[model samples]
Target: MIFEKFGKKRESAPPHQATPTDDSVSISRRNFLKKTGLFISGAVVGEHESEKFLKKIFKVPSAEVSPKEAVKIMPHKEKHVSAHSPEALSEPSPEVSTETSKESSPLDAYSFLDGQIHPVAIPTGELAGNTFSDLYAMYLGMPNGTVVPETLHVDFKENLATLWRKKFNLPARSHDERVEREQLQFLEEHHNLMNLAEYVYRSYDAKSPNTMTLEEYRNDVVGAVEKSRKVFVDTLPLVPTSASEDGVFSKDKISLISKMGESLTADTLMSLSFTELMPLDKGSANAQVFGFLLRNAGVDFIDRIPSVYDMLESFGPYQITPDALSPKSAGSWATQVLSALPLGFMPWNVDELLRGKENIAAYTLAMLNIAQFIGTRNSAQLKCLSEVMHTLPSTQRAKAVLSFVAAAHHRPHEAYDAFDAFIWSMYVERAHSFREEDILRHIPTKDLREYTGKALANYRFLASGASVNNST
Candidate 1:
């Protein structure tokens, strides 16, 4: 993305200007102070003091004065030369062009972070290349129209890392330690589901054997699924059908039975009626609710569960529950719950889905399924989710998906914070007036609420005039 700087032609200085003299040709204090405005006090300076002051002001080498010094010498030569006029001395010296002065001025260049501006030093040396400028444009673009070099040097890297740590409210730790701490926090939160949680943790951990290769990572995930399956099977009742066919009637089943009664004759109803009817299962109810909401929201669901299951299974390895599944046995059961919407549903307007409790539940269940599938932190799964999220109609829903993914993963806090930064960048280009809090408010998921608070606090810290330069 880097662009090469187009070299602009410069006008040459007029030949009438006098060449600069060496330090040996010293001007008196009165003449020097009047020309360069380096007057320390009203008192007159000696010859040696004038030389030192001139050298300091011009930043010239001991052996030679810079071209700017030629202007100071021109004033003294007024009586000697009629061609070298005062106007020539007033003209911008060749060495100090307007563009160069503007580039070096701190007032002309600033960086934006969460909508606040901070002065940035102009880059120099190899760092002056276009790569850094493109990087800034890609990530943290300049809010002001001024073009300043934004390089990736030691200072810039330190600033970014410091900003990241401050946003997360994390203590000073190496990247490895931070990852470990996050993993441990995850384990503490999901201790009851340690087998699956640990599998996800180890799979994503940089130090683990699971990350040694793609095949190794896949094998580890499969092993975790097998372990979870064993636990589920061991706890299962001896007669599965008996438990499934319990006499308790679900609300939907009760409504159905009541409707059937209305169509039946009194004698026929008495003979055919059973003492108890099994209620619709929780999964069926969720599916029914999901279908209803989707239909209401203008989505046509043709064979919701089957179609959705097919799509979910195609997303590589996903285990809805520990039960036997397809597309690499570790597939998720939540797929059936999420499948209510058609596969081609992209740029989906989820505003309608946020209206009612049933819609929320259906959406939550679908997200939960997606979270489970992504919990493994498999690269392929993340890539797929990223693609799907981008296809979402609005940035709000994309952020919601990101928040859900973060919540379902091992490091929800870190994930949420990172996405917050991303969201800020996205809005910077899309809506200049929209603040980070404004964008955060639109995110539908509660999972990101706490993280959003922390992120805002960090932003406030930056906005409160706590300087990035002051950070360690």
Candidate 2:
């Protein structure tokens, strides 16, 4: 239904556009960089590089700086924001201004994979087919908090029996019962350790103002526990004529998944990084242990998957698998996972959904990914891509690159070939999609191209070759 609305709006809205002016067109790359807030290190290209590029392109006074010149520019410095809990977004406080009451907590700046290694630089060679287990230890060792004993409990059989016996109040019957009870008790101890692991993982939030108070966290955890219990009950097998028919926790996995889906709230999932919360590989990980309970909920709940992606991003970017050597191969993994994800579930567009920032860099990246995959690469096609990409702020270029690299891995050549190919397509699409008529009537601007061309130049400078293929 939501997609239906999107389709209708796409068809009904006036397409975006810019009109040709009698005045000379100013489409230099350098000037555009400064205008779009994508200006990086100009130590490589003087501040006036865009102006120079414009001059050369149109025989104007603009200076011409080569692409290599722009790449030398160091990226702008950023202030770091700290880890925040999900409930923290909505907490009522005197510290929050009345004006910003409606806003959710901003995304955390912590990187999931640690450090600022470029994806292009990583060698993804021997790691291609390594089972997730081979990489598990490394992930556990990550300092942003990967280890958890309660969540990582390895004795699933014992844990299951314990949970079953406790929930069902089964009586001790024989030597077998004695063994099961002992196993269950052992699992209980192990599961506690897993819980501690997650606590350590989430401990980083202690540094942020948005981190939940101990009281609030306790409440949220209790709520989450209750929700999980309800799901368990709903998924429990129906009782037969005899009450003694209490079998183990066995039923269709999908049924359990559906129950879990109903039990899950966006807030609960949003509270922790996806990886920490969903650590499917962890022995006692709730998401791994209980996630199967929600599989039947369908892709709508796919939003849960982003929980891990968010965790990964919070940890920064992981550059390599245990054995993979080619950065491209590793880079492509994110592309495949992200591309398969539906746009609705992405974290980039909460504002866009409310009809704000139609040209967010993250949103444009998704669109660009789709366009490049679906359309032939051409100048007209790239023009459309550029139209949108140029509109995004420079800070978002890395994000755009990250998502694109992820999608392109499946078809490496296509990804490499379509880099600029998609950009050009976007320019054309933006032109066709522009509602020139609407703008002319409702907007006071005489020429969209003036600002747009400048914006494009700046965006290119910001996004230009931070080395998508190799770690620069």
Misplaced by over 4 Å in model 1 are 1-167, 170-211, 238-472
Please, what are the lDDT tens digits per residue for candidate 1 over residues 87-126?
2212221232222221231111101111222223433322
Predicted structure 1: lDDT: 0.25
Model 2: number of backbone collisions: 91
Per-model lDDT: 0.25, 0.26
Worst 10 residues of 1 by lDDT: 269-278
Q: What is the TM-score of each candidate against the true structure?
A: 0.16, 0.19
TM-score of 1: 0.16
